[model samples]
Target chain A: MLKITNLHANIEDKEILKGINLEINPGEVHAIMGPNGSGKSTLSSVIAGKEEYEMTEGEIIFEGGDLTELDPEERSHKGIFLSFQYPVEIPGVSVTNFMKASLNAHRKANGQEDMPANEMLKMIREKSELLEMDRKFLSRSLNQGFSGGEKKRNEIFQMAMLNPKLAILDETDSGLDIDALKIVANGVNKLKSKDNAVLVITHYQRLLDYIVPDFVHVMLDGKIVKSGTKELAYELEERGYDWIKQEQL
Target chain B: MELKDKLISSFLAFEEAFDVDSDIHEVRSNAIKEFESLGFPSKKEEDWKYTSLNTVLKHDYSVFPKKEDALEYRDIKKYLIHDIDTYKLVFIDGIYSSHLSETTHDKIDVCLMSSALSKSKYKPIIDAYFNKIVPKNGLNSLNTAFSKEGAFIHIHKNKLADKPIQIVNFSTGNESALMVQPRNLIVVDENSQAQIIERHQSLTDHPVFTNSVTEIFAGKRAIVDYYKIQNDRASASLIDNTFVEQQEESVCSMHTFSFGGKLTRNNLNFYQRGERCDSTMKGITIIEDKQHVDHNTLVHHIFPNCESHQDYKGIFDENSTGVFNGKVLVEKEAQKINAFQSNNNILLDDKATINSKPQLEIFADDVKCSHGCTIGQLDEESLFYLRARGIPLKEARALLMYAFANNVLESVRIPELKKRITSQIALKLGVSLGFDL
Candidate 1:
């Protein structure tokens, strides 16, 4: 469902992601473990079409179409979702309103009529319950004054609402407690399907235990150094990225 | 007569007709002389640098007479409150229209200044507070010098009114340039509470100007919520000044929503005189297509332990201009005062402009005061977030702008007024943001 060939990106002349090659098929989960400043987040951001990063080299293909040329919204309409490392707090915009706008935008892009308000409300209620989010949270301003765990769960709730084809979870488990991590993982697990893919990017291997991945890639110094099965995540977590750095050297 | 000559003649006519008494006639005359000295400010004036009042000043305008045009109550029935059983006051062309107004509460007295001019019971209150806070300079003095008729509302001591009072001021023209000055004085006595909604509208599409001044006094422990809605015609020019004075432990909240006008200026001043007094001022202006809106707010904390907050936002599109100047003053004795002021604006077009200045003048130590202003466009990330969800770009922009202005509208306490303003704001966003409603 996704392909990257020597993807090189940078911000303001500083190279972040250099020659990153990865491939993911449908119904598969991939975990990218990297140390700090190792371009793990940059790779996800470049794929999500964040304009801050300049693509210096290479290309990305999503679902057989060139993804590098698409705008962020277009990529989003193509079912690409990025759970931000730090969710933005948009004041005065309610969660339900934000979700409805996003969903309707995607539908409009795909030439579909907007979902009826009643149906949307029902869907939100069901998904919010699944994510263990209070209905009142939907009425409050989007992510304003929300706790870290609540924000992560809200991101998962939005993912469930949009039902993207590719869900990229970036540090979703960083600020979450054990209960929140399980709830978020459970939400992701429920949304897993044969035609969709999940990319979990994390610094710790604990998140991998809840949402087991089919493949794990160790990233160091702006490049993916090794690719293996889920066992690699445990190995890296036990021994730390210092061993990976030595191997790269 | 030439344009300038006609303007001078109009000023002289107002100066001749003004009823100046012994106590304040000197002050009023001095104000009139000052008005004559300064004349109508052109674009050259520092304060009128961005806003050109030449259209209003150069026009051969006449004042609307008190009994010239007869308008019925049904002409403005759409804006009246049918559900709430309360006092209704009507003013046409700045003159109090007794035929269109109705009052129910005995303790709450609502009467026209014309009637009060003849009666003795409310004469002292009217004389004491009328045109008291409006300074003798520039547009305010001109308004006072040319003022014709208005309403006087006095809530008796300790009288808790059951329903909010509604004031609807309408300006009508007969295909000629005309000016209407509506002066109001509202005094809420000790331990009293009330809500007032002041609505201004135009009866004709022709060019009409309304210069209004309202002075409010909230007594000890009194609470008052004042809302001003300006939805005039595109050809109308509005200059509204509202001054609120709070006594010991009194609370005052003012919300001004400016949605239409060729050029509109709102001056809101709050004086926190007594200890533990609280004041909040919020306003939102949505201007498009050559329109200009200016909001100047000042919150003065004179006593100790007073708190004040001011938030104003503007959305300008299609060569429109918005100006916001918010000032918070904490006196030397006003220690432990908490004052915050913020003004933010969004410019949707390259030609659209916004000038926001937050001024903090604190003379006391151990006071918390902060003021800041932000001028920018819509967030690109948030826009992308919405568009990615399948909402079109136009709808997404409108939604974001609506959310931006919703911060101010949510502070309105009256549900009906809040909903009405919200729908109006939505319509404005739809029109300005190019989204189909």
Candidate 2:
């Protein structure tokens, strides 16, 4: 469903993703494990079309189409969602209003009519219930003063609402506790289907314990050096990344 | 002739209609003398440092239009909050439009300033509060001298107005260039409450200059909410000077929404005479093109245990310029006072300019005073976050700006006015909010 071949990317002339090749098929959950500054987030940012990162040489094909020239909103309308590590705090815009605007924008891009208010509310209620969110939480300003777990859960809530084709969870497990992690993982697992895919980028395997991945990749120094199954995540957790770096050397 | 010289001659011609030996005439004489000494403020003055009147002053604006132009209510109904019940004091070319006005005198006095100045019953109030709180300034004196027709609102003790008051002044471009001065006086006695909305609109692209002064007195335990809607044409300019005084346990709030105009200068001041009074000054300015808007506010806490809050947000795009000067003062005897001031701005383009200054003078040893000023661009990361969620760039930027100005709009007590301002904000941002406020 998604393909990245030799994705060489840089931020301000400093190469972050040197050379990387990865692919994920439909219904496959791929977990990318790496240490800090290993280009895992860079790969996701480049896929989502962040403007700061320049693609010196690479090709990212999504659903048999090149995504290099599309703007971020265009990429979003094409069903690619990035659950940020740190969601921005947009004060005075409630979660419900933000989602409505977003969903209507998507519809407008697709030449579809605006979703009815009843259907919109119904969808919000269902998705928020899946993430175990309070009704009051949906009325608060988007991510403003939200706890880490709440923000992460809110991200998954948005994921559930949009139901993107390729979802990238960038460090979704960092600030989550055991309970929130289970809720988030369970939500992702429930949303998984044969026509969609998820790319999970995380440092630890605790989240992987709940949402098992079909393939696990170890990224070291801007390159994916090892590819294995879910067992590789456990092995990395048991033995630190240093052993992997040593092996790569 | 210069515009200043023309105004002096217009003042002489305007005074001929009234009795020259009356008490009101004496006040007008004193005000004109003050204006003659101080013709107009220049950039050299500290208070007018960032905003210059050179361009707006260059027009040979007629002090008074010779012909009284009439307008159909349907054409200008959108300018007023007509959806709600209000006592409207409407004007066309500085002349009172009685056909378009809804004045009342049964329980409260919601009528014209001309009648209030000439009538016998309102003379006591005119003598008491007229020009009482206004500090000596060229613009205020100029407006005071030419003050003939505006809104006059007075609420008695222990009485509540049946509805809100709306003062809307419209210029019809009858004169090649027109200049109007509107004076409003509001006195809410003890245990009374009132809501007022003021607006200045030019129907056409006539170079209209409006110099307006409003004096508001809030009595003990009175609640006063006032809003100013300034969205004039590109050829219009406005100088609004509002002075308010609060008694014991009074609550007074001012919300100024300046969206469009060639130039607008608002001087708003609040003085607390008794303890436990609260003053709120909130403003939102969104302007593009060559529009300029300035907000100058002061909150003086004289008695102990009073509080004041000032929050001003400005968004300047294109070559628009904005200025905010917020001042707060707490007297030595006013202990346990809390004064907070915040000015935040976003310059969309590189050429857009904003000059923000917060001046706090606290003489009380036990007062808490804090002020903060911020000038920055919209966060790119935040913008990306919104755009990534499928919201277009234009709508996303508008949403962010609306969010930035939303907190100030939250304090708007009038529901209709709040919704109107929200819609205006959306319109100014050139996007649809897609939902009700």
Candidate 3:
């Protein structure tokens, strides 16, 4: 469903992603495990078309089209979703309204009319209920004064509402508690279909236990060094990332 | 001839047309003398440093419109809060339009300023509160010298106004260049309540200059809410001077919304005379193109235990410019005063400019006064976040700007008025935000 060829990204004078390439097929779950400053987040951001990062020498093909020339919104309309590590707080926009706008934007891009008011409300109620979100949570300003758990849950909630073709979870497990982790994982698992894919980027294997990945890739420096099955995640969790560097050397 | 000299010469004709034998002649003569001495405020003055009036002043504005042009309600209904029942004091080319007005004297006085200033029955109220708190500023003096007609509202003691009052002045553009000075007087008796909405609109593209003055007197325990809507065409310029007086336990608040205009200058001042008075001044200015808006405010706490709040926000796009000068003064005897002033601005493009200055002078040893000012661009990460959610770039920006300016509407006591302001903001941002609650 997604392809990255010779992805070389840079921010300003420094090169972040030296040379990286990865592919994820539909109906499969892929996990990229890396340490701090290993370009894990940069890869996710570049795939999502962040303007600050310069794609020095790379072409991202999503759904058989080049995403390098597409804007973030255009990529979004083409079914790409990025769950941010730190969500921005918009003081006056309610989460429910935000969801409605997002959903309608995608519809508009496809030359479709906005979802009916009652249908939109029903979808919001169903999605928020699935994520164990309080109805009151949908009325408050978007991410304003929300707890860490609530912010992460809200991100997952947006992912569910948009239902994009490719879901990139960047550090989604950073601020989630055990209960929130379970709920988030359950939500992601339910939304996963044969036509869509999920890419989980994290440093810990704790989340992999919930939403087990089909393939595990160990990323170091700026490239993928090793590829293994789900068992590789458990082994790395036990031995730590230093073992990967030793094995590479 | 120069606009200033033209206005001075026109004062004689204005006096000859109006009641020269009336009691307000002395006041008018003195005000014209002040305008003659001060001329028009220049950029050399500290108060007018960031704003220049040279372009708007060069127009040979007809000091008095030659004819009173009639307008159909349907043509101008869009400019008013027409959804609700309001006491409308409508003016066409600075002349009172009786057919378009709904003035009343039942329990509360929602009428015209000409009647209040000329009728003997209202002489007592006029003699007591007419221009009592107005200061001697150049534009203010010009407004006073030519003060003729506007809305005059009076709520009886312990009475509540039946409905909101709307004062709208429409320039017909019948003349080549028209100038109007609308004088408004609002006096709420002790323990009364009132809400007033004022707007200045130009019907055509002809250049219209309006110098307006409003004086609001809030008696003891009275509550007064005032709204000024400055949404005019690029061919229109406005100068508004509003003075408010609050007594013991009274509350007076004014909110100015400037969405479109060539140039607009608001000189708003408040004086707290008794203890525990609450004064609020808030504004939101969103102007694109070469439009300009200036907000100059002052809150003087003369009595002890008084409180004042000021929150002004602006969004300047394209080549628009904005200025905010807010001052809070606490007298020596005014102990335990709480005065807070905050000014925040966002410049969308590089050419857009905003000059914000928050001044606080505290003479009392025991007072809490804080002022803050910020000018910057929208958050890039926030923009990216919204864009990533499938919202287009323009819609994302408009949403953010709407969110930034929505909090000021929270204090609007009327639901219909709040909704009107909300939609007006969306219109200004060029987006139908659909902020339905």
Candidate 4:
């Protein structure tokens, strides 16, 4: 579903991701675990086409097109989603209206008419129920005065509503408590299908326990040092990332 | 001739037309003398440092427009909040359009200022409140010198106005350049309530200058909401001076929305005369293409336990300019006063300019007074967040601006007016979604 060849990215003069290559097949979930400042978030941002991070020498092929040349909105229209680590607070835009605009924009980009108001409402009701979000939660200003767990859940709620082809969860589990983690994990699990993929980027093994990945890649510096199954997550969590740095050395 | 001299000379003709035996004649004569002394405020004055009336003062304006510049209601319906029923005091070319106006006298006086000044029945109310709170300023004096027209609303003691009063002034461009001075006196009696909306619109591209003065007296426990909508043609310029005096426990708020015009200046002042009085001044300014808007607001806390708030936001594009000068004064005896002032601006283009100054003078040590000012572009992260959700860059920028200007509209008591301001903001931002998001 996605391919990256030697993704070398930099922010300003400092290189963040030196040499990175990865591939994920359809219906697969891949987890990338790294310590702080190890370019884990940078890798996800590069994939999502954040403009500030300059992709110096690389090409990202997703759904038969070079993603590097496209803007973030174009990528969004092509079914690419990035659940932000910190969602922006828009004071006057209600969450339901935000979802409606996003859904309509996607439909318009695909040469389709706007979804009927009733159908949009029905989908919002069903998806919000799946995420255990109260109806009142959808009426508040988008992420304004929301708790940490509420923000993460709202991001996932957006992900569920957009239903993108490739979902990149960047540190989605960092701020969630045990209960919110389970709910978010459950939502992602229910949305997984044979035609879509997800890339889970995290700093701990706690989230992998809830949404088990098909493969685990341990990142050191900027490159992936080891690739294994779910047990690799437990090993790294128990022994810490020092072993990974030693292995790289 | 310069506009200043023309106005001074026209005062004689205006005085000759009115009755010299009337009690207001002395007031008018004194005002004209003051105007002659002060002339038009020069840019060198501290209060007029940022706003220059050079462009407006250079026009050769006709003091009196041609009589009965007829206008059909259908042609100018969109300029009004016509969806709701209101007591409308509409004027065309400085002459009251009786055919289009709905003045009332059953419970409250929502009628023309000319009749209120000439009629003997309303003489007492006029003598008590007329021009009492207004200061001796150049433009204010000029308005008072020619203050023969405008809206006069007087809500009796303990009486509620039947509906909102809308005062609309339209210039038909009958002359090359026409100037109008509208004087409004609103006295909400003790325990009474009222809402007022005033707008100045020009039908043609001919230059129009309006020097308006409004004096509002909120008696004990009265509540008054005043809104000013200045969405005129690019050839129009407006100088609005509104003075509000509040008694004990009264609430008075003024909201100014400046969407269009060449140069618009709002001098809104609030004087809290008694304890527990509240004053609020808020505005939103969005302009482009050499248009300018200036807001100079002052709130004086004279008594103990009073509060005042001032919030002004501006979004400037192209070569448009904006200025916000908010001043709050808490006197020594006014302990426990709470005063706040905030001015935020966004320069959409490189040439856009905004000068924001927040001045606070507090003699009461126990008072809580704060002021904040910020000038910047839209939040990049917020823009990218919307863009990443498949919204186009243009739409994203518009949405951010809409959100930026929406908070100031929250205190709008009238839902229909709120919607109107919301749609105006949307139109200014070039957003397709019409209603609130």
Give the number of the best model, judged by DockQ: 2
10 residues in a row with least lDDT, candidate 3 chain B = B428-437
Alpha-carbon TM-score of each model against the true structure = 0.90, 0.98, 0.98, 0.99
DockQ of each: 0.34, 0.77, 0.68, 0.64
For candidate 1, the per-residue lDDT at B374 reads 88
Error of 2 at A152 (Å): 1.6
For model 3, fnat equals 0.77
User: Across residues B94-139, which tens digit of lDDT does each residue of candidate 3 receive?
Assistant: 9999998898999999988888888999999989998789988788
DockQ of predicted candidate 2: 0.77
Q: Judged by DockQ cut-offs, is candidate 3 incorrect, acceptable, medium or high?
A: medium
lDDT of all the models against the reference?
A: 0.82, 0.92, 0.91, 0.91
For model 4, residues B331-433, the per-residue Cα lDDT tens digits are: 9999999898999999999999999988988888898999999999998888878878888788889888888887899999999999898888888787764
lDDT of 3 by residue, A11-100 (tens): 996899988889999999999998899999999999998999999997899999999999999999998999999999988789998888
Error of 4 at B372 (Å): 0.6
> How accurate locally is residue A22 in candidate 3, as Cα lDDT from 0 to 100?
91
lDDT of 1 by residue, B125-231 (tens): 86777777765556777666555467677888999777888888877775377777787778999999989888888888777877788889999999999988877
**Tens digit of lDDT per residue, candidate 2, span A137-245?**
9999999999999999999999999889999999999989899999999999999999999999999999999989999999988999999999999999999799988
Report how far off residue B340 is in candidate 4 (Å): 0.9
**lDDT for B330 (candidate 3):** 91
Docking class of 4: medium
Q: Label model 2 with its docking quality class.
A: medium
